[model samples]
Target: MKRSRNEHNSSQEEQEFLRESKLVARSPQHKEKVKQPEPSMDEIKQMLRDLKKDLHEDMAQIKREIQNDIREMREDIKDTKKELQKNREEMKSMAKEITQMKEEWTREKEELHNKIKEVEDKMERMEKQKIRNNLTITGLPTNTDNEDTLEEALEKMFQTELLLKTKIRRAQKIGQDRCIVEMVEWNDKIKILQGKAKLKGKDIFIDSELTRNEQKIQKNIRDIAREEKKKGAIVKVGYQKLEVNGKKMKWDHRSQKLTEANKLKN
Candidate 1:
């Protein structure tokens, strides 16, 4: 039995050896994958340099894009500046045109004002011509109590003092002391004015009825005449003449005179 047991043991060992040998057989397809060695320092540096070059190219591209954006912005700014300059020029032109129009309007307004003043002066002169047949008697005591009695008194005074065959158009008491008499005919106005010397020294006188402006103008003329009288010049304040020392001096306006070496018509 022991010998059988040893033989059995030997057979089992041999079978086990054979199985191990079969399991451990070297197959050509089952080669071990060899891990590559760690890179050397030079190779590592080359890889890092390649990575740096790529990074630099990307950064350069970004920089070029930024520069293009900046250039576009500058062009936009230039366009905006041009538009602003154009607007400024337009505003200046508009302002100049407005100033010119204002000046023209001012001139036209002044011309219109002057024309209106001239027309008013002409109308006043025409009005004075209409009332040329009227005379204002000074120092004539009017009948203030009654209108008919006043007219009768004026009629009687005219019959006595003025020897004129004239009819009274209207005779009214203007103020408390004076009377305005309107004659019927132009001849009557002449006769009454010519016969004023007859009523002289009786605290009365006759004067042609003139406008207030004309009265002021006559007063100015009389003032000039008074000044000439002081210079021993025989000055008379006529309708439009200043007879200064026997020379008919034309009164233009104010104290200015257009003088001529002409004698006064008798």
Candidate 2:
């Protein structure tokens, strides 16, 4: 086949390159490759030492970085431990303060209760003093439908039954059958109470008027007196006390019952 002009030029250029390469290979001006001599033991040792030094330096750098990281971690752990210990100490102090507050609250509560009780006793004493000259008449029949009032009826009964002319300051019915009578003179009240024995066989009765506190105390004493009498002991119920075998017993406000008069202080 006939080659094109450009193809013919490319084939000629390849042949020229081959001929030039052959000449350059055979010429003395182009020096032959020298044979490399084997390394001596000293040189080989030096190379190994250089390589080891480089590797050791790299390894030392890595070890230092790791040690620094470990130190930082230890510091963090120490800091965390210190924070935890501080929290524990704070909690202990708060617990101690709470305990102290609780004890103080309890003591103050008891003192407040005692002060309130003292106030109540003082008020009760003043109330009892006001009604000292009053008397209570039980089992005295009152006719509400009759024209005669309770006061007129009581005055007539006192004059007829006790043979005494006592001037009453006030006369009022308290409950269903009881009459509270306030006498003008303290001596008149004393005489009326002494004359109560005359109406013993009849259904009438007379007794001193008592305050609410005194009534409660009298009730407690009567209960104790009844129990003592059941045990064959000599027992008597007084104003607000009980006499058991000649031993005087008073009402204890704290215990809310009768206690021996001597032991009441204790």
Candidate 3:
């Protein structure tokens, strides 16, 4: 039985060996894949150097761009400053021109004003001379429309009321109760004015023919005389003058009022 068991074990081992051989025969052969070799130290250093060179080039380009931007900003600031300075200069010049023009205009205006005043004074003198030998008669009746009749009537008045012989150059009715008479002689007008008080009871009046400006001044003088008379102070109104309390008053063209004659002596 031991011999049979050994033979039986040998047959099982032989069958297992045959099965392994069949499996090895039927399977495909696999070749070994070759692997890449690891890098040496020198190769690794070279790669690192190339990467560093590329990074440095990029950094250099970025720095150059930053410098260009800074230079452009500086140029812009310089241009702005130059423009501001130019504006300031132009404004100053304009201000100077305006001041000069204003001064010249003021001077011209003053000269024009003085010239107008001078012309007015000259015209006033001419007007006063034109009416030097004229007289204005008031309180006459409008009895006739004839110029000869009016002249005859005024001649009769001079003969009867004033008791003065006067040659009437021209006599015309100016209004219902007024007439302006031009005398051939200036002394005749003076005589008629001097003898005007004689016709006070007859309701006849005589006065010198005055310019409009003189008439206004005479009116103001009479007003001042009336006020002084009311105040119990002696006042006399004559032609274009006023006398208050025995002091002569002159008309001030500048002030347009009566002022003491002595006050203007200074």
Candidate 4:
């Protein structure tokens, strides 16, 4: 009976230990679950290949886009260079035009200066020539009968000194009362003689060269008159033929041979 009780106690102790181990394993917090193993090496390699192919496609598309962008940039650069060249040519043309205009303006300015100088010189010459130093007297009474009356009238009209030189006589007759008077200066005589008409009643005669010649002789007579004691000496005056504006007239002498001789003498 004692041996059997000892065997029974040992079996009961073994059962109790097994029951406590089962309770401990059944508690949720203390349980440890087993994990499945990873996939095989071939499966992992197939996945890696798929990912690599997608990455290659994406890289190729990015490279294509980069190439297109580079091509566009190059074209833009080329167009910009062409535009710059065109602008440079335009600037050169404008510069040439400006230079030409400047040269033309310089020429015009010089020409204008020359024209002004010429005008100034012409004005100076005209001013010098404008000095009026002579006088003219005309229209003495024809029937006044004496040289003294004519000289007095002319002296009063011109307000100048007058000298009576000679009394003109007919060729075969005695002295005619017609005479000539002279001023001291040629310019004074020219002023009085040029373009002057003399009126003797109804006849108006243009002052002839005969009148001028007579005036010259009159000047000589006045010089001779100063040395002569006789105041009434007859003075012989020379004759002349005058051609004016293609018209001819005989003056002073009566003989045609004497007139021809006078012309030859002149």
The candidate that wins on lDDT is 2
Clashing pairs in 1: none
* Tens-digit lDDT string for candidate 2 (157-244): 8899999998878888777788788888888889999998999888898999888877877877777778878899998877767888
Q: lDDT of each prediction vs. the true structure?
A: 0.79, 0.87, 0.86, 0.54
Where is the poorest 10-residue window by lDDT in model 4? Answer: 166-175
- The CA lDDT at 244 in model 2 is 83
lDDT of 4: 0.54
For candidate 3, give the lDDT of residue 39.
Answer: 95
Residues 50-113 of candidate 3 have per-residue lDDT tens digits of 9999999999999999999999999999999999999999999999999999999999999998
Better by TM-score, candidate 4 or 3 = 3
TM-score of each: 0.53, 0.60, 0.59, 0.37
Best by TM-score: 2
Best of the two (1, 3) by TM-score: 3
- Residue 182 of model 1 has an lDDT of 81
- Which tens-of-lDDT digit does each residue in 131-222 have in candidate 1? 87888877887647566676677778777888656777887777777877787787888887888889868998788888877777677778
Given candidate 2, what's the lDDT at residue 118?
A: 90
Model 2, residue 73: C-alpha shift (Å): 4.0
| Candidate 4 lDDT by residue in tens digits, 1-266 | 35798799999999999999999988988877789899899989999999999999999999999999999999999999999999999999999999999999999999998898788667755643432222222333445655566555555544432232322221111124333444445565554454243223423222323333345544554454444425654434323333333334344322322233335433
